[model samples]
Target chain A: MSGAVLLSLAGCALALLGGLFASSPLSARRYRAAAALAAALIVGGVWWVADPRGDFGHPITAEAVDANGAPVSTVLVLQRDGGRRQVRRLPLRRPVDGAEYALWAALLLGLLGGGLQYRTRDVGPRWLAPALPAAGAGAAAVMFARMGGLESGEAGVRAWLARFEVGAVQSFTVPDLPWSAQPEGTVALGVAAAVAALALASALWTTPRSGGERLIPIGAALAAAAVIWRMIEVGGLPWRPAEGALWAVAGLLAVAGLERSSALRASTLVGAALALAAVALGA
Target chain B: MPRLPRMRGPWATAWAVVASPWTPWALGLWVAAGAALGLVSEPGQHPASGLVLQLPAALLVFALVARDLGASTARLRWAALYAAGLATALVGGWLAGGEAGMAEVGGARPTESYTRTIAGRSAAAHLGAQLGATLSADGAALTLAMKEHHVGEAVLPLDGVREAHIGRWALHLVDVAPGDEPAYARLKLTPRGGGDPIERAVRTGSGAALEDGTQIAVLRLSPDFGRALGPAAQIQVDWEGGSATAWHFVDSPDLDARVGAAPWAIELVEVATEPRLVLGVRRDGPIGVALAGFGVMIAALLGLVFAGRREGRS
Candidate 1:
């Protein structure tokens, strides 16, 4: 099948395995490690596939002609194919200001804080923790997906999907986006880098004798920063249906990690109810 | 503290180095090597947008070193070294020709008439027009024509269209271009059963059986006239009019998006007229911001993982 489907299946399998093996203490550590690693890889892989640097081709070119069969000039050159360059003029007359960058920044920061709180070792009944984010994220994702579905009729969805395809399959090029260019080894190299970073983290944790208390803040900051940067790069809302679903999953996992029986029971009931509600409402 | 017996030789030296809190420097060196490789590969040839991408490695290295070295003076040195590493990356990106200028190009509605012509034989031209003006053809080949230019269509002798891209948008021709049996198809654009033309036009569907050498009129309706025809709205039939039936009736919208209700609302009718096509420049906002957004998402995800693992350790 498609690489995306394959990768996603692999990730789901890993997450499942992690959850399954989490019954034993020794296996719990392995479970967490596998889950985290798999989730992280999926996240990275999706982003890479969606934004393949080398595959982003430009839209408008310099040699483009107008409707009346005249050459198109006075537009920004975005891509160059052979000798023809795709170009489009700047400063469209009317603009749609949907959401500002500042808003996105705020949302990302909030997600980071929420994630931190949910993952914090001591806060709340352990079982209640992950469910909080999971429920909230899931609710938000479902709502956003509805909106996106409505807009599926518009060209926006197709264009967005085009970016993903173009990034993956090298042959695809968006003639309208003339400036699109792909980054060569970013994917393979990025994955390798991630693995190395994970290894390094493992080494650090294993090497230390005890007392992880002091390192928590630094780790938190790194996580926050990384999440922020990644959110920015992904260029969509955290509540965007696809990526937002991942966050929801993260939330659920966080709650599950808390390990409190009543909280787990309550969360399970609430989650099941929510799933049922979704199904009923959808039907 | 009681002194333990001294461990000697290569393994001891290696352990000393590994535990020496100088691992950050080693990590930094390794990071540099990775960056070097990334530069060499330069898969997509995307010029660097900003210093965002390199932050994860820097943060990871700095946090690791700072945690291992404690809050001592040595940690301060590591911080400075981390900054140096970042600076080196920025410089490397610059050397590799990554950064490009970001010019602001505001968004515009696709409600205006737009025309794009592709020159050279076997060349395809895509013009971003109002979504309303988009039409479908159900013949062996699909051809679109500009008012002034010759009406030409792709002469592919294929029956079914595997896929299609109109301007930046992908569309399904199955809706407008009937089943495989039709020899020719015509998409009409005139408003039906006139309301005040100033108000919304009741655009009902009208079909013209297309035969060889069949000519159709492409109407360039006004914004007021176009807005009346909403999504899936089509004209019922062509209205035979008075003296104004002359060429002057065809309206070309102003390119400025603000000047009209919608910039690309000029409709394409299926009847032949002196003024057949309304051609003009169709503009949309520059895509740099969107590109930047995609970049930000990627960098953030990577950073999150790095931070998550690093924090777990600390």
Candidate 2:
């Protein structure tokens, strides 16, 4: 079987087992625990397997040639193969939107925060219940709107494969971003950072101290902020505050619901509602 | 002092009603039913756009009502809600669209003058052009032979067809190529009465039976098109001179989707063509949304598991 089919099968199986165990009585506590763990794994596994970048079905890749047996079309090109560094590009298609990457990362953080809050006896900052998701969604929207990928001018996947490159790493280089290297970009980024830091500081204030739990929300907050920064500053994305805020609303609702408590049932239900809302608005 | 029940008034009453085990299932069913309506008109189009809203609404109902359902029965009821929603959606998708797709839309129409070309000077361009052939279907594969002279015919099977058009192309009766018997077979054409066909053009990318440079057009049927046509069914082909020709078919449509629709790549090995549109499946959208949906479901299940774990612990 192809890797995707195997992954899908695994996901379906885990989901099924999880459902069954979820209803089992106290006598089957062991099975329930195992099922829950399996279900958790399914969430991550399915996401990875189904990602647009995952290229789930098509495994066959061939060069399109002309009548003279010369190559005509290609899809993907490897700019650098990693031992020290790796880079790949599709000349025709827009590079993977940085905003998309940010959105997924935010989701990861959301899941992480929810998991972390499970053991806490006391809730973290009441404000965090709303602020975190708002920030996350807003940042995502802003980043997405700014992406070069979404622009009409951006090329498709066919173009990306046109150029093929392979090279050994000579030296690692950090490409300068508009946000970091330029003054205007730096100021805007700094202001956004300050606003985020204030929100996070407030959230962390009331959080319980155990297993370094404080880092969870902070890390999540940072991830969201960083994604926004990367999109605008480095990717040279446009500014659209309203769109950003809308996504922020979605993010806020999502995180608030999921992070409210570690009680699996309640959180899941809440998470589902908020996440769906986010997708509806943003997608 | 004895503590009175910490809740009171209309708010408390609302909570009591929502806490009932059947509420989630009932609500979920309602959502599925409502969403299924959007898919009813045409399943072939895969039109599930309302899913974007319907899914959120169902989830929101659950979220709004989800409270401390401390007992086993309540948890079981919640699981039932998930099952019901899943079942309902599956049924909906199936009814609206065929199996894994959507739309009961329309039937296929005949195509005319579809061509793909490879611009190489000496590239082995293979093409298939057929006329007045009697087809025997072996589930998308056909044992086709010209009725008049038993000329160029091959068993075209699963994934062995490239571009198939249902319109006009003429048969060059005088042009004949002696093809290899086992692998490549020659076709000899004998026209009853027609001058539209150029009797010298050939497309031999893989093993087409006409001479090289014979500009020919043949009816390339859709996957299972021949099978769907039953034995000796007449197929229409518009001739180059505004005339129509009839070809016979055999068998039934292979219900298996792959048999009806082969991967486009499979046809490339057997047939080379001029530039033409190549269609393939390319799914684009946020898979993260699907993941999130599953995540929510699993998390709910985890809650049930935790409940069990806690009960066992206690």
lDDT of 2 at A178: 13
What is the DockQ of the complex in model 1? 0.03
Model 1 score (lDDT) = 0.27
Q: Chain A only: give the TM-score of model 2.
A: 0.29
- Candidate with top lDDT is 2
| Local distance difference test, each candidate | 0.27, 0.28
The deviation in Å at residue B242 for candidate 2 is 28
- lDDT per residue for candidate 2 within A17-107, as digits (tens), equals 2322232232122222222222222222223322434433322122222333223322121223432222221112233334335445544
Error (Å) of candidate 2 at residue A63 is 18
Which candidate achieves the best TM-score against the true structure?
A: 1
